[model samples]
Target: MEEQRALRPPWALVRGAGDGSGWPWRSTLLLTVFVQVGSHFAAHGQEGGRAGLDAFARVLLVLACGQLLWRLRRPVPVVFGTAGVTALYLGAGYPYGPVFLAVAVACFSAVVAGHRRAAWAAVGLLWAVHLLVAHWLYRWLPPSGDSAASWGQEAVIAAWVAAIVALAELARVRREQWERERAERAEAARRRADEERLRIARELHDVLAHSISVIHVQAGVGLALLDSDPEQARTALTTIKSASKEALGEVRQVLDTLRTPGDAPRAPAPGLDRLPELVEQAASAGLTVHLEGEAPRLPPGADLAAFRIVQEALTNVVRHSGSRHARVRLDPGDRTSLRLCIDDDGPATGADAGGGGNGLAGMRERAAALGGTIEAGPRPDGGFRVLAVLPLRGEEEVDR
Candidate 1:
């Protein structure tokens, strides 16, 4: 039920009361009826000296209520107008009753519309005028032998006005808090969406870059040996077919994440267990991969980050480096972190080779998401080196 209300538009609670369109006919009619009918009962109970409900008194009540039709449209003026009309009715010695309802509603609307000072000023003006008429001016104003009102009665009236203003102020504060919360929720949702998009982009880049690089190298070998060595050409074609099929499967798995998010993947993600496959792929691409130290066991997130870091580093070497020899080394650092380094020998080919410079960036993002880091640059000796240090435990554990 709470979710349903949150999903609804902000104005659903108020309907169109604050839309500033046609008059709020239903509310206006209700107020008019309440004041007109309730005033007669109030006058009947008042002391004999007060004036009865005359036609002029009824007209003043109607006029005060009528100003409420424009309260949401021009709140400041409506509040003051209602206060002035009600003050006049009181000064005429008419018995006080539901007639103040109009002034309360107008002031409430004004404060809620961010015209708080104006609402307070109008209420203050009405209170001051009532005090003057009830005390100093009542002798000359109405009820031929009327006496000044008691100070205790004046105090009660002041308290009533304070209560109404306090209620309006409370409502205004709550509305602002609701609006602020809604904005924060909206911003958080957008940020989550942006992060999801980036995650999918990195997944696609890693899957396609390594596989396509293998296919590119294999296709070249097949074409070069097609006329001279048919058997070797067949082997190259076989490698191409295998590389393309694996790429498609990985791409499908990535897409499945988008299609049904939050579900376990149909196939487990690649990790250091697939290092041999990466080495074979590199060998097929005419690059020799020399595996050094064994990788330590890591959590799923860190495992995937480590695998991708290695894959992207190898892909960069196959595409950008002229040297065919490369080395991959793993360092189980102090039992808390897993570190891996990829190094290639000799000068770079200066070729981006269809990997749009996102390879290194993707690797870095993967490492960072796992509370790890990536360092990649040209080595002082020759070629390039990529070093990634990922925590052995989960991100939550690492934080602790």
Candidate 2:
């Protein structure tokens, strides 16, 4: 795991740090003007440089001072140009003051532009040039115990400019670290939100789907048997009462899943153990369903998946295809997969709102949740088929 860096100060987080319009250039401009003027003082302050600059040296300073305002917009070019002019001034026996200012500004611009390596390269070059100018041209060194204040001044200015550049580099690094951490935290939050939404969608599918399908089938049963078998009709009425209560409990449980745990106990949901009830309910609704194979009770996730797929597929058979007969086949497919094939000998009449429906799509979604897949289309014998293969991580504890 990557450790997050401490957040940078607010002044750093505020964007637009180095735009041409930002304070960087404006501050650079002020410092540059001060440096250009100070160059003249430094030259005069030195031993035998000239009482004041020659006419041409003054002109170079004038031009460099003007160009310094756009340093952030064009850092590298400005530095190279200033360096060339400074070399020319040195060769002409002029002062190094304005040239040093230009080099410092150039380094600042590169760092602000996110050219960290380039910035360091510029720093090295500036230090090298300053040392060469001091040794070969000015015959200068830092003031030893031997009284040379001019030598000490040169050393002081060099240290000051280096410190400023170091601070700028620190600011750049801190800013980059801050941005990376902020982005990671936001991505984590987004992933968690997505997980919560998926869990809600699953609960909604399980509770609403199972309860509504149960209610619809039971209501159909009571109505169909009302004119035929009064005893069975009364039993269906009792079943409807039971289903409605179960639906209420399921709905309450689903709503409770949204609440904090200390609120209440959830009504435990049904699994494949309720397959007989589902089969009986389908029979009561006038469809003949045959169950085979001793199925092992599966993991809660796989069991819920099996139940939902069967429920959705059967609802689709009744609602979409004109199928009076449907066969459900569930057999263990080796050690890791359970295969479910529901074949309905019903003609596709192209009924129920011309094909876009919830039944098939819901089945597919449920299968996908368990890393399984479903395929539904016309079978070879001119009937519809719903085939699904679900993969499980563990074997069920019981066989029934």
Q: Top lDDT: which candidate number?
A: 1
Instruction: Enumerate residue pairs that collide in model 2.
Output: none
Residues 1-400, model 2: lDDT tens digits: 1122133343332322434254455555565568667876778776364334768877776566555555556766766666556555554556546566666656655676687676666566655665565556444432222232266766786787678578667766876776788899899999988866665676566555555555676676778879898888788777767767866776677678677644654554567677788777666555677777656667877887788788767766665667778888888878577888888988865544222455667678777767778998888887888888888664332221
| Regions more than 4 Å wrong, model 1 | 1-28, 47-49, 397-400
The most accurate candidate by TM-score is 1
lDDT agreement of model 2 with the native: 0.65
Tens-digit lDDT track of model 1 for 1-400: 6676556544323423633345676778778999999998999989586899988998999999988878768889999999999989999999989988899888888888899999999999999999999989997988889999999999999999999999888878877887798899999999999999998999899989999888888898999999999999999999999999999999999999999999999999999999999899899889999998898888887888899899989998988889999999999969888889999995788766577889988988898888889999999988899999888786687657
Backbone clash count, each prediction separately: 0, 0
Report the error of model 2 at residue 2, Å. 22
Q: List clashing residue pairs in candidate 1.
A: none
Cα lDDT of all candidates, in order? 0.88, 0.65
